[model samples]
Target: MSEIMENPKGGCVLAGINSVLSAIHRTCPVYHSGPGCCMQTTAADQGQSGHKHSCFVSGVSIPSSNMLEKEVVFGGVNKLRTTIQGAVDIIDADAYFVLTGCTAGIIGDDIVSVTNEFKTKGVPVYAIETPGFAGDSSLGYEAIWNTFIDQVIEPSEEKDDKLVNIFGIVPYHDPFWSGTLEEIDRILSKLGLKVNTFFTKKQGIETIKNSSKAALNIIINPWLFKGPAKKFENKFNVPSIRFPGLFIGATDTSEFVREVGKALNLDSELVEKVIREEEEYVYNYLAQAIGVVSWKRFAVVADANNAVAFTRYLANDYSFTPVLVIISEPIYRQEDKERIIKRIENLEYANPPKILFLSDQYEINEAIRNEEKEITLLVGSSNDREVALEKDIQFINGAFPVNERLIFNRTYAGYKGSLTFTEDIYDNL
Candidate 1:
């Protein structure tokens, strides 16, 4: 008997290309697959991030071989070679990377050889065989790092003691990625530490090349990257800290800055001073929004990371109750699922939420309509707006595939992010 699939989240691999492509400005992702994959990546990115951070060749404008039946049966090497060469010649790009899909990856094309040819021509090329069938979009994220570590990054002789690199964020995958990174970057800068958020305006492709120079790599989440971190440590002799999640609220943000201070063995007096000033700034705006957060019940639909992070911020900072949480982060491994459950279970809540690991839109919509307790507020992707409307509750966009507002480096992280988040949600209500 065929096994029944319960609420299958439509799998994608092209999203990986967008993650890497968006990191650097003017970086052309020469898609080595058919036209459909390129179009899908372009369409998805345009719909979400096009308002502010959309790059030179994100969606349909991306260069592609657009493989056909004949190329599928025989090979797409010649077409790809032509495409890359033409792109390098025509497109004024800082870097050129290629991602392959099921068709080209299945055919076992010698992609490395082709990319190396352009590399020999001093074209700044990198390529990885990231097929949708290989894994989810997350794996494509891994591919980008792996290609950079193996191909782009060079050995560093000198390491900066105060320099740290931030890892674990999947750009474009998270709706507020740019703002979040910048927030953390700003906080770290305050502490007299240089930060490299791999995908930033000043530190995009350059981060890949200079990654070896950092003394520490701060992984923003537990479930992000290990292989790349390991490789980085092995090469540069840098230590790393695995922060549970992005520091969203005041207490959490203070704790993160303090912990990072401790990790780097910086002066306690200095760290405390910074935290005090930042917290004061955070709560100054927070005081005005107390009435908004007071006596409110909420439900959130988000990926596992946001579900946990936002829940902590809501409960700890403003006393908003999370009645139900829909964690949409894909759980392929039993351990990942259990980890999320344990994390949510351990969270301190006045009225804990009934958490569901769901991807089905129908199920998620139903979960929000609670007869037991009315959800006064919602924090999640744009899809949850309909449910919020049906329930006549206020909705706050905090996750991926967002619309109705543009996320241009606005964050719900650190002291500034806490204030920004508070004003954002409070103003909406």
Candidate 2:
């Protein structure tokens, strides 16, 4: 927190719109901020959503108020109203959301009022307040749900036992979010369960509208969607189960599927049958990979969710040694911090103290420096690229600020995800 370093992972709160835009299907983000603010500040971090620069929603091409000095002094409400109305006319959006940035937040613009004014125009308009000054990207990520809870959500009373809703895989922030979501969908599909991940290519406005109709909700992490999940449960009378992370590797994923099965009152025999089929393919793939992956040692420098799941998978399944596990997000909640720590300590060669929480890039690099030779692989963000390069280690990006690869529906969770992880690491090797 004290020392600064270059190109650290993550971004400000306003960048949360990137995830919102990416996951909300055909939804558009109408910025209540100044011109080019969304693109200039957050596009690179937005990385690549399949819908990039589209009129619907991407890191670029957001319909912004473009408030100039004239509007700033006189209040930008008129401009925001005009922009919202213009976006409704222009963009082919299933739903529209209004988000504010630093300028609008500081000037105290009534974005909510403007968005609500268009309510009866045969479209849904949601509003979220995201000032860069409010907090970091993680908080911004959680704020998406809060905005949903506070602003404009029409509760769905319809129930569909065959459908489920997934949360906590933040788009853009988690590079493989769309892919991971797709993989999860695939797994659930085999169980006769349809999932709505909101932002992935397959889902759209219908997913958002019918989210409350699902019999159950699955939040991938406890940290990000706690508020939204709870509010949703109360509002829609739907129950939820909180998974540790993206069901990375067999052990966790098997439990994830079974848990879903139990929640849905699915037949145990069918659930076990699905797990057996998935594991058979996974182990068969690993059979030929044993020689290559057997002795590899790795260091994980990722957010809390990836940090815990990646460490568990490497040590338990691949027999890879995890020399260091650095979680880049500061622990704000005791329960979340405790859960992550427990997950790490429960690893095969678990060292609780080695599971550190540090966001400063300088500190992360410094910690990585000491174990340079021992750690043969770096599973982290672009920030750790310099460390991996200097140490001559095999590196793979599994977190934010990734520029090396374009990730879309490429997952690292469940059986298929494990295979993709193997393929990527092997390719890197």
Candidate 3:
């Protein structure tokens, strides 16, 4: 039996790949799919995500083969070759990636062979054969990293002890990705570490190529990049630390700092000093904003990473009652679900909210409507706004498909970011 998903958030895997590649500076994604894929993929992630688009190339501007019936019947190889060459000639990109759509994948176009031809000519082009039907947008994130591990990143004899690479934060898809990465980079910099956020600070293929020199790979998600992380470790000899979830507010952010410090075996004195300074900074703001907003039971509908961060921060940091939390992403593995459940359940003060693994909009709405617990504050994406209104709850746009807000360099991670998040909550109220 098949189920119909209503108003599902996020595009296919192609959109995910496109979003990632486009985020990198001077990197171009040349699509080898039918017409409208370029635009649809762009709209799925970047378009609805905080009204921001890639500065390098995105949306309709990206090159595509636009595989038609003729090309699909006889194979779109030659057309794809020309399209890649044209993109390489016109677009001043440092590297190019050929992303196949369902059309190319269904017709069995040899994208690897075509991309290899460009590679022979010293063109920095790679092929990602995974189509939109392969998986969701998160899979696209992992697929791109796999491509990097296999094709882009090179081994280095010397590793920088102070350098680290960040993973699990998908660009455009998260909407707050740029700001979140920048905030993480800013905090890590105070710890005498150089952070590679990949999507921010004009980092592109060159940064990725040299990422093998990083001392550690910090994956800030509960369940993503598992295979790529293993492959990265085996190939580059660099270890990784999984943070389990994105950190928000002082408690979790401070814990994140300490964890990173411990992983690197950094000086305990320096680590404590940094944590003390950051906590003091946050507490100062907390002191001023005490009782500004009334505490109420809240429900969050977001992806796994944001869902965990929101649930923990609201229940633990703000001392707000959590009633329901719908993880609005497609999570399959039982271990992953259990891990997410564990994090959401083991709250500091409040009881764990009811957690549901849901992606379809209809089911999500029905679950929220049928919740036994009362919800007063709702934190969700734009798509969930209507449901909140129907329930007459206070709603704030906190996750992806953020159509209402213009979110450039705005994040809810780390010490300062938590303040911004608090400010938004207050403002919304």
lDDT top scorer: 3
lDDT of 1 by residue, 1-429 (tens): 233344333236666656567667667888888887776764554456425545577667778899989898889999999999889888998899888878898898888899989888888988877675676556667777777778778789898889998887777777677788888888889999998887785565777788788888898764667677788778668788877666688878888898899999998999999999988887777676568655678777876767778887887777777687788656566766666666666656566678887776777777777537777888978777887888788888887657678767787877787787877786887
TM-score of each: 0.92, 0.92, 0.99
Candidate 3: the clashing residue pairs are none
Q: Which lDDT tens digits does candidate 3 get at residues 1-429?
A: 356778888989998899899899999999999999999999999999999999778888999999999997899999999999899889998999999899998989999998999899899999997888898789999999999999999889999999999999999999999999998998999999999999999998999999999999999999988899999999999999998899999888988999999999999999999999989999998998798989889999999999999989988999999999999988889988888899889899798888899888988999989898889999999999999999999898999889999998899988888899889898887
When sorted by TM-score, best at the front, the candidate numbers are: 3, 1, 2
TM-score computed on alpha carbons, candidate 3: 0.99
lDDT of each: 0.76, 0.77, 0.92
TM-score of 2: 0.92
Number of backbone clashes in candidate 3? 0
* Model 3, runs deviating above 4 Å: none
Ten-residue stretch with the least lDDT total in model 3: 1-10
What tens-digit string does per-residue lDDT give for candidate 2 at 33-139?
77876775456456533323333555557788888898779999998888888888988887788878788888898887777688856568877877766776677
Q: Stretches of candidate 2 above 4 Å error?
A: 1-6, 48-55, 349-353
Error of 1 at 252 (Å): 0.9
What's the CA error at residue 358 for candidate 3, in Å?
A: 1.0
